[model samples]
Target: MRTATPPPPPAALTVPEVMTALRLSRSKVYDLLRTNQLKSFTAGCARRIPTEALRQYIDNQMGEAA
Candidate 1:
């Protein structure tokens, strides 16, 4: 029997990934970061968004809609 492959570890998302995920423009994603609506960190010159932060943002939006 073949063993199943383990899933890859979660990784921080780049700005482009966030844009694709949210279907928002690059400026909009940066706007969210600027306004503190989304949390992120910079490593050197690269900005990355944690998966949990994105999830929380989504949850907050859902809550607001209800």
Candidate 2:
């Protein structure tokens, strides 16, 4: 019998990670953070945005654009 497979890892994205995902500049990402549209959370000493949140934001923006 085959055993169940493990689930994939949840993507934990840093500021630079998110920027790389979207091909955005560091300043542009920080601009979104400053504008109050995009939100970020700090874990310990590091700031990270949930990949789901970023994906949702992108989907919403795409929906609006279309």
Candidate 3:
């Protein structure tokens, strides 16, 4: 019998994932979240950042930068 390998996770990322995606520091991520620059929300009263939103945020930021 052959073993089946698990597939990779989707783009639903957490706070740390957002930070890595944005290549930003932890404090900067927090600041962005505070300033409403990055899209996120509190799940079960805990803060969570979605990967797609972070990607969109990055694209917008790059657009602004350009």
Question: Against the true structure, whose TM-score is highest?
Answer: 1
Kindly report the root-mean-square deviation of model 2 from the true structure over all alpha carbons. 2.5
Per-residue lDDT over 1-66 for candidate 1, one digit per residue giving the tens place of the 0 to 100 score: 999999875678999999999999999999999999999999999999998999999999999999
Q: What does each candidate score in C-alpha RMSD? A: 1.4, 2.5, 2.8
Q: With candidate 3 superimposed using the best TM-score fit, by how many Å does residue 54's alpha carbon deviate from the native?
A: 0.8
Off by over 4 Å in 2: 1-7
**Clashing pairs in model 1, backbone N/Cα/C closer than 3 A:** none
Tens digits of per-residue lDDT for model 2, 9-60: 5666899988988899999988887875567788998878887778787987
* TM-score per model over all chains: 0.89, 0.76, 0.71
- TM-score of the candidate numbered 3? 0.71
- Assess each prediction's global lDDT (C-alpha) against the native: 0.96, 0.83, 0.80
Pairs with backbone N, CA or C atoms under 3 Å apart (clashes), candidate 2: none
lDDT of 3 by residue, 11-30 (tens): 46677877776688989989
Where does model 3 exceed 4 Å of error? 1-11
**Residue 37 error for model 1, in Å?**
0.2
The clash number for model 2 is 0
- Misplaced by over 4 Å in model 1 are none
